[model samples]
Target: MATDSEKLGIKIERNPPESKLTQFGVRKWPNRWGCPPSKFPWTYDTKEICYLLEGKVKVTPDGSSESVEIGAGDLVEFPKGMSCTWDVSVGVDKHYNMG
Candidate 1:
């Protein structure tokens, strides 16, 4: 596999038979699998727009213990300085934007 830094800005499409792809701090996708993965809190230095293309995730904020499950076609936004832990369950395919 080639590094994204070594390639042009491209989009990875998740279609039938092919699933699960991650692009650095750009985007990730998991198809049909249960319980995607647990990840570290993201306190983005840049604004992040997360749109749930499928499945559910438990998003727990830092400093505060509040969490929520956002699923299919849902939208979530986090500005700079916001930190949170992401517990993705029942798989997920989402588009991400960070710069």
Candidate 2:
């Protein structure tokens, strides 16, 4: 089963089957992002869902020490207004779009 956790408005769903995600229209996201290992900061103005196709990342929300690790086959949601830093430890490729 997929596991989901929410804190400070971010949500992560681990290891969700691709079929189930497709059924929910996950593939409809218009953008595909690919990045080499790096660290960057971001802020979301609208909710965003990311479906990882490869590699991994750790997202640390601004002002919080806690972080969420995401990788291939994972589904992650960043809520509106959240500020965070992404540490792409293994680089990554994913489909993402605003919700």
Candidate 3:
């Protein structure tokens, strides 16, 4: 987990056991999102939790040169008000929920 005064809040559990995260149930986050290799900007209006099922991505927060790499089997959390650019290197597939 990491946080910054002017940037986003992110909590990542790398390679967590599938059982631990899956217990939350897919029904809770029935929507799935996928993107081909590309870069795009996004803003989180609400806190979000996502489970990556495939592919890889590098997320760079707005105005910062720093970034985080995420891939399959990763559990990621993004706090509300965080704005960032997602640079998908190998495309992406994930299940997500907002609250």
Candidate 4:
């Protein structure tokens, strides 16, 4: 069964499980496949787990204006009340299930 999201040329791996954004009451995607060479604009999420699957990204946590490089095989647990930006440098492909 294909979904509207699966047609985006990206696939989400379901394994790590889903999580919830306690602050905003929003669901966080446990995995996400950002388009290749795609640049995720400056946005912030209260709580989420950014897992690297097949690319590189730079994230700037809220309060602290510093961008950290995230690569494949790496996992980042962004705490709540944290605002930040994401810049996808390389391929963006991940499996994410949110709460």
Candidate 5:
């Protein structure tokens, strides 16, 4: 069965290989850090690919009841123009690129 993330058009790969990270040059991407117990709305102006180094979060797309859970060791992609609310339960540290 398709996961909630798939249904929401949010892609997530858990604990991907190092080669894949290297292929995407994930280490070179700019980093983003967020503290826990916060909620904020965000809209993606461009597609974003990120690799989470630490922390956990739940992102609920606008107009949806479900939230997609993401955490450390995950590689995730958020589509361009997607509007969502980020609920950060744990502090986050990640590398991200937008295009």
Candidate 6:
């Protein structure tokens, strides 16, 4: 089934299969962490694929009224040039790759 993110053109896989993770070499990706209860604006210069290891977050694309909620076990892809605001309600730990 398609998620809200998918509808917005953001790709998200909820608890994808292990084979998919291995195919993507997710373990080799760099890790990032963020503290909770914070908000920040960001713009992606390149496409990014990330797998969340923990925490919850809400990302609202610029000029959009809806927000996409993400949390542990979600694998998400953000297309290049997408501007957004990240609201972290729980701390985050994740692995990410950019291209």
RMSD for all candidates, in order, please: 11.4, 1.5, 4.2, 11.5, 3.0, 2.2
| lDDT, candidates in the order shown | 0.52, 0.86, 0.81, 0.49, 0.86, 0.86
lDDT of 5 by residue, 1-99 (tens): 212246498998888888888999998776675566789999999999988888899999999999899998888999999999999888888889999
Number of colliding residue pairs in each model: 1, 0, 0, 5, 0, 0
Q: Whose TM-score is higher: candidate 2's or candidate 3's?
A: 2
List, residue by residue over 6-85, the lDDT tens digit for candidate 2.
Answer: 76677778888778788768788789999999999999988898889998888889999888788898888888999999
Q: Which wins on TM-score, candidate 3 or candidate 6?
A: 6
Q: Write down the TM-score of every candidate.
A: 0.56, 0.89, 0.85, 0.52, 0.89, 0.89
Off by over 4 Å in 3: 1-8, 26-28
Look at candidate 2 and tell me the lDDT of residue 41: 98
Give the true-structure RMSD of model 6.
2.2
Q: Is candidate 1 or candidate 3 better by TM-score?
A: 3
Rank by lDDT, descending? 5, 2, 6, 3, 1, 4
lDDT of 4 by residue, 1-99 (tens): 211122111222222333323332223544455676765444323444545667777766546655666566544455544456677778776544332
Candidate 1: misplaced stretches above 4 Å? 1-35
Pairs of residues at least 3 apart in sequence or in different chains that clash in candidate 4: 12-95, 13-95, 31-95, 31-96, 33-94
Instruction: Quote the lDDT for 95 in model 1.
Output: 67
| Cα deviation of 30, candidate 2, in Å | 2.1
Show pairs that collide, candidate 5.
Answer: none
What are the runs in model 2 whose C-alpha is more than 4 Å off?
Answer: none
